[model samples]
Target chain A: MFDQLVAKLPVGICVVDEQYRLQYLNAFFLDRMRPDQRHNYLQQPLISIFPEQAKFLTRRIKSVFVLQHPSFSYWEQRAHIFPFKSSRPITGEETQMYQNMEIVPISGPSSEQKLACIILQDVTAQASYLMAQQELASALKQEHTAQRKLIKKLDSAQSQLIQAEKMASTGQLAAGIAHEINNPIGFVTANLATLKDYSEQLLNLCDALADKLQVTSPSLAQFSAQTMDTYHYELLKEDISPLVDESCEGLNRVRDIVENLKQFALEESTGWQLFNLHETTQQLVKLVGAQYKAPVYKVSCNPPNLQIFCEPASIKQALTNILINAAQSIKCKGFVKIDIRATAQRVSIKVIDSGVGISAENIKKIFDPFFTTKPEGMGQGLGLSVAYTAIEKHKGKIIANSNPGRGTVVEILVPVVHPEQRHECAEPLGGS
Target chain B: MSTESVLTADQRDALQELMNISMGQAANSLAHLIETKIGISIPKIASVTPEQLFSMISEQADAYYTRQSFLGDIQGEVMSVVSQQGLCEVGALLEYDAPLSQTDIQEIILELSNILAGACLAGLSAQLALGTNLNMPTLFSPRKANFEEFQWSNSLVMEVQFDIEISSFSMRVVFCLDDASLDRLTQTLDELLG
Candidate 1:
């Protein structure tokens, strides 16, 4: 009964001698072997029977004999040390069996002769299940990374869309306001001119009347002189001309501001064209200087007539907005300098202002739409944002640096050739 | 119950002496197999709370850990702390290639733990005239395990250290026995003492 129990055990059992000759095979092992080998496999070398794993099996069996202790081999290190098919080949994920083997030394009657028993256990289901779980976890990690990247991209695109919508609507509103203000400015300017001429004529007529009355009638002259004294006519005669001239100048300024508004709102007129950077900078400084006379405006260009192909209207608008900010930043005597330089493929413009510089935190949001630190009704906060949008259209870059108490410097870089014309220019240069 | 009262001073001394002989035999077996000299320290026997056990074993920063259990006459576990330093030299002694892969390193660690832990348990069981079988050893991480909710509050712990003379390699083997095993062990020590 004991022998039958050992023979019918579920595990694979094989006994080998010192020379690695198979001495016995249990029923579990014999049933898995070929019909001829099952009947006549006794006393055969273990290596000859299973030559594929002979080297590894022999080494392990030798260790057991030498140490006289049990030696173990796990499936994690060496999965299949035997050439056995899976018990359930059809339903299992793996066709080859995964086995964990153990070798133990046994004595045969006398301690002088040593024998080793090999026990193999199938563990295919456990290993395959664990591997599948690991693969799924790694796949999940990759998907998480890809999703985070997509969310970041979506956030930037949404912000850009919001900025574009605000710019379009603001541009339209500015155009409408400019058009409405244009009519009032025109009539006010015409009326101021006529009033100045009329006041001048009336003053001259009074001077002529005073001289004639003095000569024609002494008594009448005395009356006239008294009336003139009572009215302070000499002071009036001197201040009237200056008052009218100041009014006319003030009206002209209002008209110029309106004209600037119209130019800034010319959204449809923006088109790629060859523009002179030097001339534009000079014009911008002169215009902004007239409004904020406290700051001294200086302009310079390396090549006096350096030209670039770009949207002339928007480029001018962007520079105008930047110059206005520089000029306004100064409360007292300071200098605002514009330096333009042209390289082979690009132009660089630097606007340096000796004014109360922006704080570090404020500089970051200077280009954000509707962000401003100015007092109410002093600024609309759209100036820098508009400039940012215009330059971005041309694929140019703008950067600002400032020291709180010192000053601020704004730098801009624009490509000399438009992207559409870049190909055309490259071909000629290559040929030459 | 107090852990010191579990065994008398005479019993503790006898058990310590028994562990010394068994641990020395384990070191000798390893030396014989590797053809190198190995040194062993005297075994220390104590009763410790789970918290003390966690602190004592988890303090080594650069070490590999393995745990194996044994059953039959007494039920207990063997926890080994193998220093990472000079592991490459130990791998060389195990007939592994110079540049060891992950599988090769794991196999070496498992194999070493098996040979040493198995020999020590076998020697001790033989001296006590008890039958015991050691289960397979597996890699363990003390940091990952939660010790606060451990089932056992206190255990009888036996500790020993082995150092390979040719390299800077050292490993600490700790055996923890349950309450029933502790009782069985002290009773057997009493019989030997009588």
Candidate 2:
């Protein structure tokens, strides 16, 4: 009855003598081995029966016999000590059995004789489930990283959109102001010219009346001359024309400024059109120079009148931003030069200035929105960033080179025709 | 308190001999259950502060620790330190399945401590003609802060080591007697000697 119970045990049990020769095999152990090998395994060395695990088995068994204690081995460290198939070989996830083996020293019926017992237990399902969980965790980590990067891109794009909207509203405001100023300037200009003509007629009438009075009566003429002397008539006649001329010139200047503001705003047509690069550079210099009077503004155009098809207002805005930056960089009495060069298919505008140059560190972040060196409320630091966006729209490149306390140079290159339409044009100019 | 002051030379000798015999019985019980040869070292007796006791147990790196308490004629706690190496072999001998989970390892530590500590306590109690009840075992980590905060100023410690011949496996068991238990133990030793 005891033998039958031991044979039916779920665990694999085998007994080996001190020399490691197999003495007994329970039914669980016999079932795992081939029928022929099972019958012949008795009295055979344990190594010969499972030659592949001979070294490991021998070591464990020897230790058990010498120390007279139990030795343990787990599947985690060494999965299968013996090459055996899983109990559910047909439906199991693992092809081979994952075994935990233990060798224990046992005394025979007589305490003098020593024997080693080997026990095996299978555990494959637990290991497979753990591995699957680890794989899922790693995949989730990768997905989380990708999502973070996409969110960062979306954040930058949203800020750029907001900046563009602000620029559009500012342009509309400028256009409205220019239109209102033009109305008053028109009438003021006309009334000043009419007043100048009416004053000349009044002076001519006074001169004729004095001449007639001198001829008609010497006393009356003498009285009239005395009255004219008391009124300082000669000085008044000399200053009137010069005053009218200066007033007219000043009004003309104001009109010119209003005209430039209207052109800069370009609210009438934002569409693409042919634009003269040299002309745009000159206008940018004038507009910026008015505010930053410390800089001596100069313009140079090689093969003048280089024209490119682009959005005129936007190009002007880009150049204006760069020119103003150059002028403002000067503390006092420095030169700002605008050089325009054109190839057969492209145009390059370079704004060079002798001013307090940017530091090496600040130059790198100058084009990033809201990165400013100026004191609070003095500058918004959006100038270069706005220019960068406008130039990008034209499929152009802009670069800045500067040295601290020396000077700065900003260069912009734009295709003569928009890049998308350049293929239609037979010749393309290479510009740097 | 010093070891000599706690117990006279005769009392110390008598307790040491009794501990040796009880430890041997504990090892035999484990050997009988696993059908393996288990060797035990003679027990060493000492009077130690909590810090000393902590260092003695925690000095063994990569070892599993457990604590059990007993009550009745003697009141004391038993701490067992088992090496992590060759644990798989021990697990198999106990009929545990392969690829032992964390819980399985914990269970093995607890069961091993209970068997060895229980047997030693039972043997000592039987020989002394004292009645004692062993409590369940629990896993313990010997952290310095916790040891420093322990309420006892000093304890009488009896320590022993068990080595298994079949595998490179060894465990140390430490017995600590509370103040009242120490008095009881010395009184019982004197009676035995007399």
The digit string of per-residue lDDT tens for model 2 on B115-136 reads 7887788778878888887666
Against the true structure, candidate 1 has what lDDT?
A: 0.84
Report the Cα interface RMSD of each model, rounded to 1 decimal.
Answer: 1.7, 9.4
- Global lDDT of each candidate: 0.84, 0.82
Task: Give per-residue CA lDDT, model 2, range A324-428, as digits (tens).
Answer: 889888987889998888888778888999999998998999988778899999877777888898898878899999988889999999877864674344234
Best by TM-score: 1
lDDT of 2 at A394: 79
Candidate 1 lDDT over residue span B7-117, tens digit each: 788898888888888888888888877778999988878788888998878888899999999999999999989898888888887677779888877887888888888
**In order, what DockQ does each candidate have?**
0.37, 0.07
State each model's C-alpha RMSD to the native: 7.3, 10.3
> Tens digit of lDDT per residue, candidate 1, span A309-335?
877767887898899999988999999
Best by lDDT: 1
Worst ten-residue run, lDDT, model 1 chain A?
A423-432
